[model samples]
Target: MALALAAPLAACGGGSDDSGADQESIGLLLPENKAGRYEAFDRRIISSRLSTLCLECKLEYRNAGARSDIQKRQFEALVNKGVKVIILDPVDAHAARSWVDAAAEKGVQVIAYDRLAEGDVAAYVSYDNEKIGRLQGKGILDALGSRAATADVVMLNGSPTDPNAPSFKKGAHEVLDGKVHKIVYEQDIPGWTEAEARKKMAEAIKDLGAAGFEAVYSANDGMAGGAAEALKSAGLKNVPLGGQDAELPALQRLVSGAQTFTIYKQVRPEAETAAEIAFRLLRGKSIKSLTPETADSKSKTGIPARLFNAQIVTKDNMEDTVIRDGVAPANWICTKELAAACKSLGLN
Candidate 1:
């Protein structure tokens, strides 16, 4: 279970002593790269913010590649390396209890990032996951319009191991249960794999026929891409599809009418918040100011937490949200094939 570590990011310029005794190390362990946000936004933002916060601090980062065993090993390695604070977005939130407990035994602090990890964590940073789900359900309703009254829907949920997945599903059901005609098919995808999503979506189409479902609710953008491909292969047209994480391709799909909408949880602020908390914790400062709210996991209660809000992104508000915030720049989403869609949306 030994992980191949990436080189630690050393902060540039000097404000504090650069000697080994004066240096501080913080570890960031993210769950997976399939969603792209971890590597694309979270890692960079957290690293930069930490550099700004502590000029002599070193950031050690590791990605589990969606394997809990790998993440467990990485966590152990960081603790062994004397990293006093670790920001962990667990690949399997349930499996994190022992790891977090072991870290605590060694006097290490754990900050649950994005997804809540079980055990005694110093702080938690993430979005209102259930609200994201409600917005996703609303996206489907909005796309369905008049047809929502009798429309059949398919639900493609996220990983069962991810703690946030259930909240997302619960929120979506709250919004869609009585309002929609029926939920014809539902599957909880493991690891949020796009291929698994595609296979399940194809299976649903096979069992229910091409016209069986009127819309699809993918838990995140990565799965939405798979669902889109399956829909296209089945020759299913204009079946409203919604997903979370307004990723670049998802935003492109939104403009092209392939995806109805996506949930954009501003990642920079979330990453920065985690970074700031880690810095404060390293400096022995109280984080009560940063964490105004509280969260509870199965193993622990009343944990200090900071939850950000999410927005539903569609073709109409592309400019106002993701583009304006620079989460996904206009040029990044406005590729050559999507130029017409971009121009029509005034993005070009």
Candidate 2:
């Protein structure tokens, strides 16, 4: 894919650190705080690692709160602030092309973080999103076991504006298209917000009836919470639920049998790697050395990318995955209500 109209301005962004400036400023703009991971994981890990690696580096961070306009302004602000590099997780992938262009015009190199921004960027760091979807599909099937051919499922996907959402949907469909009994309902969450998902789930319940679907394939933990709420309101039980991100709530739910499974995409490495790349960009080092793999964006192909693997987390292996890996705290996962479940899973 060709980059945006501003592709030619890529040279404007940064220069060599010959002087070894005492304080190099870099911007980290996350998509939103709705999923919890962006704040609790991405921002925290990225900032910490950047600070650890470059003691004199200043990290400017912002969250878009699920608004495209806010993200645009934040990007512009980061650019105007004279930051050397900007790591952006766009709220709206298509709309972000202009932001990338703007940054490039200011000589600020952009790193597409988590979500693919539809413009030329220095690098991208994220999980294999399609694999996330495939894992989710397989999780659903594993939960259904031999009854997969007779199970009905509803797909609650992420926002249509997110480029990763389509990749996730495509992969899920690859594994689930003909395997399940029926896909009773499927809709993209407008903003990937839990509230939007809750509203959609309510609609699905009304349209598909309480017992119409046997499982729900929620794109992430936030939507899984929303789906769980709708299911509870309708008095459904043991309905398989699939989620990603492995958020605390999702892990809790997984142990409590409220969620069937979740995908854990080790965020520490992803964040630390992005931080390293930002420092490298500031120092005029080759980003391709760290991210040898490449991915295609709407406006660019052969974009340097570092994609990580994801693991499926279920109640059966919650301890081995989340707890053992230190992804989630035992106290966080083993709540009073979930104590028994946690103990059974050897989480405690």
Candidate 3:
């Protein structure tokens, strides 16, 4: 993989540390508020990890709402306000390069979050995006079973501007390449927004010509929900759909048989690891040896990165994955309405 690094502090729309001394604040910029996990997990885990390591550091947080323009503007704002180290998950990888360039120019370090940003960064952290796509493809194929070669799967991919989108598509295509029957609809949802997904999926159903599609391969849980809604409108019953991020709603849908499975990336480990990297960078320390893998970006070469493993999560195995990993507990999923289902699944 080729890496492109653009840590331009000037193009960041003014978010950089202009203070005379070395005192630094850590700015954390996430992509969107639409995904529940960012607020529910990523921010808390990263902050907690940072706090555990040191108390002097300050964490500045912001959301981009799946818009590259907003992110570019926000990046400038953070730098202008004077943050020492920036942890950014790009809203649009390529568009982010200019802002990243600006940050680099200001001498403030930038760490690429879960979603890999284009260009040079202090450090990069994320799961194997290709593996996620492969898992999703395999899960959908496995669900199709005898119909794997016969079924027409609709591909609901992630944002076009996001670098993960193509990697995910590549991973999935590796499994689905020649064996699958057909791809009636292959579309990338912008910003991973539910509304966009819903609209695109409806258009797909119309394009596929009513009841012509069999299964769906959605990149994440949010789009999966949108695809599910579109399928509901089409009045199709029991066609397997794939998703990632074992979100509460997706888990419920799996239990109800509306969805087939999801790719569960142990988020805590990623967030914790990122926190550690950011803190270490803040201390002016080296983090090269700590990373287990090397990721290539367009602007930079061989950036040391942490790539976590992704697991397949289904209704039957949620206990073994999320429950065992402490990512989620039975209390939330095993509510009064789902008490029987929880018991049936052997989760107390």
Candidate 4:
């Protein structure tokens, strides 16, 4: 819970501060604790890689708990500790602009992790937002099979507060707009929680009825599972659902025929990329190659960004994608209950 603290990164490899001292402490700020991947897999991979790259470089980890004010305080805490660099996933992107400016004023490099901040970040690392949505939208059509043309789909979007959520929605709409016959219901769930998604989906189920909806477009795997739950509660069957993030439970649901598809964004490489960029910046090295293009937020213009592609993973290709990439273990996904399901779907 306390961010799985480890030895300084400089201990594994030779590293020093800008003044050529031995110790190089880097602060890492993760956005929230709601999603399990942030705390466990992402943090672990990033911390280990940073340590390996900058031996004796300390990684101070803190969680923002999805509050902008809390994240601001945590950023100050890291700054007060005299860290050379801070990698942060902003809880609120627009609101966190001031923090980035503050860190810059104090001569600390800020690497915007996962989510892009409003101001000019030192370096940004995340998957292609629009592409992620495109993959999710295409997944829905593919899962619908012959019904792709006629399926009535419902969109369960994420919070309006999160910038990434809208970006994802835009991407999905790109592939789906004007293609499907009818959009029976479209609602953006406020909290981005499974419970809220389920409640809203239940209402959709009520408004549109079982026969009316052929598919549901849930933004992430968590909400995808929620939509599927609502469908099952309504005693429905064969409804194609779309999601991303390749979560363990959602992947299992895929194998068991409870869900349709989820996108697999390679995390280790993404995190490692961010870590390497952060260290390179701390050493006052140029990172022009790392950036692909310039992205504009509400407040800032032409912010440098490093964007990666996302892969689509359906039930048929889970083994070859998420499992093969070591995002999740085989034992965790292909369980006893999903044994026959796995074999049926060619997952094993």
Ranking by lDDT: 1, 2, 3, 4
Off by over 4 Å in 4: 1-23
TM-score ranking from best candidate downward:
1, 2, 4, 3
lDDT of 3: 0.81
Give lDDT tens digits, candidate 4, residues 147-229: 77777889999887778899999998888887787778999877578998999999998988778788899998888878888
Task: Estimate, for each residue in 37-130, the C-alpha lDDT of model 2 and write its tens digit.
Answer: 7766777677677767776677777888888898888777667667779888888989999779767776788999899898878899988899
- lDDT-wise, the better of 2 and 4 is 2
Q: Give me the candidate number with maximum TM-score.
A: 1
TM-score of 1: 0.94
Among these predictions, the greatest lDDT belongs to 1
Q: What is the lDDT of residue 302 in candidate 4?
A: 67
Task: Show how many residue pairs clash in every candidate, following the order shown.
Answer: 0, 5, 43, 12
All candidates: CA RMSD in angstroms?
Answer: 4.9, 7.4, 6.4, 4.2
Judging by TM-score, tell me the better candidate of 1 and 2: 1
lDDT of 1 by residue, 121-233 (tens): 99999998989889999999999999998999999999999999999999999999989999999999998989999999999999999878899999999999999999999
Q: Please give, for residues 1-348, the per-residue lDDT of candidate 3 as tens digits.
A: 001111212211223443434345677899888787887778777767676677666677778887778878777777776666889998888888888887898887888998778766878999899999999999998898988888888898988888888999999999987768888888888778777888888898888766677788999999999888877888876989889999888887777778999989877788888888988888988897668788988888788899998989998898888777666677766778777877778888
Q: Which ten residues in a row have the lowest lDDT in candidate 2?
A: 1-10
Residue 304, candidate 3: Cα error in Å is 1.5
